[model samples]
Target: MHDDLIPFNKPFFVGKELFNIAQAVLNGTIAGDGEFTRRCQAWLEQHLGTPKALLTHSCTAALEMSAILAGVGPGDEVIMPSFTFVSTANAFVLRGATPVFVDIRPDTLNIDERQVAEAITAKTKAIVAVHYAGQPCAMNALREIARNHGLMLIEDAAQAILSGDRGSSLGTLGDLGCLSFHETKNVISGEGGALLINNPELIERAEIIWQKGTNRKAFMRGETSKYTWVDIGSSFLPSELTAAFLYAQLEHAKRINSHRRTLYLKYFELLAPLAEQGHIKLPALAQDKPANAHLFYILCRDANERQALIAHLDSAGISAVFHYVPLHDSPAGFRYARAHGKLQVTTEIANTLLRLPMFSEMTTAEIRRVCGEIDVFFKITSKQPCELS
Candidate 1:
C-alpha cells in the first residue's frame, strides 16, 4: 500500500487544466460566461446531445434554475426520493414547494418508481429523480407517471454524468437535467455544474435565469439595445476559470470514465464472495439499465457492523465512509415532511450503506489491497472462523 491513506475520492487533473485556467485569467475575462464558459457549454451540448445548456456555479444552482423554470412555488408539491443529497430536495424547497419524499429500491438504491406515482398529488409540479451513484433510475416508469399527472420531470444527474440507459442520456430524459462537476464527481472543475434544457421553450427563460434575471444574453445577441430584470433570478453563472478547468475534464471524459470503470469492476469482482458468504451485501446492478459505475458500495448487517467495518479499514490505514442519512430523518427534511409520512426503506438503508473508495486515479493494486482489508474485517467478525494466510 502507499504511505498515505487512500482518500475516498481524489480528483484527477490533466496537464492542460492549469494552462487553460491561466489562459482564462490572462485573457482579462475571469468573469462568468466568457470564452472558456462558451467552450465548455458547446462541449456539453455536443456530448450530452441536449439542445441547450447553461453553466452554473454548482449542481445546486442548476437545480434551483430548474425549479424556477418549472414554475415551482408555494403550494406546489415535488416528488423525490428521501435517500439523496439535501441539495436535491433543498432546491425545490427553497422555491416554497413542499417535497413529497418517496422510498428507494433496495436493489439499486435508486428512487422507487412505483411509489412515486402514489406520492403524486393535484399540487404536484415536478418529479426530481436522482440518479443515485451514477446509476440511471427507471426513467420510463417515472416518465409515464409524470405524463399521467401532467408534471415536469427533472433529472438530478449530479452523480450520473456520462451515465444513461436505453438510448436516453440520464439527464436528457427529463424535462430538464442537472450535472455536477464537483471535486467528488467523475469530472471536476473544483465546483461547477450545468443545466440541460431539453425543451426549446425553456432555453430562453433558462438563459435569463442564469444571467441574474436579465435579458442580457439576448441584448448581447443584438436582439435588444438594453436588458433589464424580467424574472426572478440570481447570480448562478460560473466564472470562465471554472469552465476552463471543467473543459479539461470534459475533453478527457472517455479516458477518465474508463479508468473509473476499471476500478469499479475490480472492487465488485473481489468483494462478491464476501457478499455471497453473508458478510456484506454489494450494490446490485440492474440487468435492464446501463450505469457509469460511479460508485461501489456495500450494505452491512446494521449500523454497528458498518461502523465496525469502517473502523477496521481505518486501523489498516484505509479510509471508507457511509453516505446520506435518509433525508426523511434529517433535521431539515424531517421538519419539512412532518405531515407526509414515514420513510421506512430510507431510514433503514441510511444506517447500513457504506461507500467504498472510488476514483478514476485509483490503481488496480490499490483496489485489491482495500478489498483485502475488507475481507479480513469480515472474516474476523463473521460466524465462520478467521483463516489468515
Candidate 2:
C-alpha cells in the first residue's frame, strides 16, 4: 500500500513549461521585467480584468506589496480569518500592524462576513479576505463594509484564479488582489505569484514599490533619463526564467483548467455517497459562484476521525492530509492573538478538515481509489457522514 503514495497535491505541467525556460535561457534576459514576465502580467490583467498586474516571487510578496500599497504600519489593524496561511496575516504583521483574526464560515470555510462588521473599529485600516479553497468569499458584504467604513479591501486570491461572481473576477472585487502560482496550485511555475491592482490610484506606487523603491519603471517607459530611490520597498520580483515557465502554463490555461475541473468533478461525484452517509463534509461552492476546484477537502466529525481517515488512506496507498494549523494556536501568533477575540470555529475546523489528492493530471481511477478508502473508513468508524454531493 505504501508503494504508491499518492500525494495530496502535485504540480502538473504539460505545456511549454520546459520549452519556455529554454527560451528564457537563450534570450539572455533571465532577470525580472523580461518578455515572459510582461507577457504573464498582461495575461493576468487582461483575463482577470484588472487595471494593472505585477508579477511577484510568490503570493507572500504580492501580499507584502499590498501592505505597502495599503500603507499598513504600526498601530494599524487588519481584519482577516484565522483559518488561512500565515502570509495572509504576516504581510500586514510585517509592517507592524495587528491582525484582527476572525472566525470562518462553517460551510464554506471562508471568512464569516457577519463577524467582520462587529470586529471593525477605529484602528481597522484594511480587511484581508482570503477566498478559501478557490471559493469566492462574501465579497459583496466585505466590499460594502470597506466602502462604508472607508477601509481598504485586499483579497487573498491565492487559491482563486478564474473563480468569481456573475461577471467580476475574485481578485478584481477588491482594491488589491494576490494570487499564487505555487507548485501545489492549479497553475504552477515552480514558485511565483502576481499582485493585481484594481484601484487605479495605486498603480504608480505599486510599480515603484515593486521595483525596490526605484523609478526604474518610469525610466523604462522613457519618461526619465535617470531613475532613483524614492520609497521603502524590497526586491519582490522573480526571475524571468520563472515567468517563462508561468507563461507556458498560461498559454494552455484552458486545457489545464479543463483537466483539473474534470478531476474535481470526478472526485465530487464519486464521493457523493460518502457525503450522503454523513462521513465527511464536502467543500461547498458559493451560490452562483464559479470556482477553479483548486482543492478537494472534507471535514470529518473530529480530529480523531480525521486522523483515522488519513491513516486508512495511507494504508491503502493514498496520501491525504490536513491544511493550515490555525494561526491563533501557533506559537508566533499566540503572543499577538492573546488579546484577540476567541477563535471558536478556527480551532475546531482546523483539526477536522482533510485534503485529498487533487491535481490537474489526476486520473479518474485515482479518485475512485481514494474515495474507496474514504468509504471504507466511514463504514469502519460508523460515524455520521456529511449530507453533501
Candidate 3:
C-alpha cells in the first residue's frame, strides 16, 4: 500500500489474550480479584520472589497505594529525580507529602543516588528510585541511604518488570515496588499494574489497601468472618478482564523480553559507529545492572540536533520523539515538588534524548531503516550528505 509508517510503540498480543478474556467472562467473574487477577498476582510474586503482590488498575494506582502504606502525609518529603514519570511524585503528593526533585546520573539517566542522600531532611519520609529506561539504578546505594535515614525506599519500576541489579530483581530490592502493564510497557494489558511488597510487615496492610481499604482480602482467605472499612484506601484492583489480558502477556513475558532485547542490541550495534564518532550517545549500563530492553533511546549533541533528527525521521515515515519534559520544569512540579540540586543533568537529557521505535513485533529491517534515517540526518546536517536508500 503506502510506505510503512513506523510507530513509536505497538502493543503486542500473544495467542491467549482473547481466549483468556472469553474464559474470564464465561467464568462469570468480571470484577477484580477473580481467577485471572489471582493468577497474575501469583505469577508476579513467584517470579520476583516477593512476599506479596497485589494487582492494580495502573502503576499510578500501585504507587498511590505504596504512598498510603508509607504513612506519607503533609509536611513529609519524598526524594525522587525530576526526570521520571509524574506518578512517582504524584502518588506521595496526593497524600500531602512534598516531592523533592533531584538530579539524575548522567551515565544511566537514573536518579543520582549520591544526590538522594543530600536531599534527605528531617521531614523526609521516603526515597523513590525510578529505574530509567528499564535499567535498574544503583539500588544498593539508594538502599543504604534510606536505611541510614530511616526512610522507606520505593522502586518506581514501571519500565523494569524483569530487570535486575547485581543478580537481584530490580523491583524486589526496595521496600515497595510498582510495575506497569500499560500499552507501551514491555508487558501489555492496556491498563494494569501491581504493588510488589518486599517488606513482609506491609503485606497485610497492602492487601487491605488493594481491597478498597477494607479487609475483604482477609475475608476471602477466611482470616476474618466479616470485612469492613478499617483504613483509608481506594479501589485499586484491576478487573478480571484486565487481568486476563495481562495473564496472556505474562505467560510469554520471557519471550517478549528476548525479542525486545534482540532489537535493543541490534540498535546498539548499528549505532555504535555514530557513538564512536561522537555524533550521538547510546544508552550506558553498569556492569552489575541488566536491562529488560524496554525502550531504546539516544542523546544528540544538543536540543536543536535532536529536533532536526526527529524531523528527518518524520519525513522518512519513521516515528522518533523526545522524552520527559523535566518534571522540575513543569507547572505541577513547580507547585508540588521542590528542586534539591541544580537538576542540570535532567534538564540536558530532557532536551536531547530521542526515543527510537521499539516493540516486540518490529522487524530487523525496520530497525535498520530507522538507523539509516538517523545516519542520513547527521550527514545532511553536517553538510556532508551521503546517499543511501
In the order shown, what is each candidate's alpha-carbon RMSD?
3.0, 1.9, 3.0
Which residue window of length 10 is worst by lDDT in model 2? 380-389
lDDT of 1 by residue, 153-177 (tens): 9999999988877777789999999
The digit string of per-residue lDDT tens for model 2 on 94-179 reads 89998888888887889999999989889989999999988888899999999999999999999987887768988999999999
Go through the candidates in order and give the clash count of each.
0, 6, 0
| lDDT, model 1 | 0.86
Error of 1 at 114 (Å): 0.7
Clashing pairs in 1: none
Q: Estimate, for each residue in 124-215, the C-alpha lDDT of model 3 and write its tens digit.
A: 99999999888888888998888888999999999998998767887899999999999999999999999999999999899888888899
Query: Candidate 1 or 3, higher lDDT?
Result: 3
lDDT to native, each model? 0.86, 0.87, 0.89
lDDT of 2 at 100: 87
Kindly provide the TM-score of model 3 when superposed on the true structure, using C-alpha atoms.
0.97
Q: What TM-score do all the candidates reach, one by one?
A: 0.96, 0.96, 0.97
Q: Give the TM-score of candidate 2.
A: 0.96
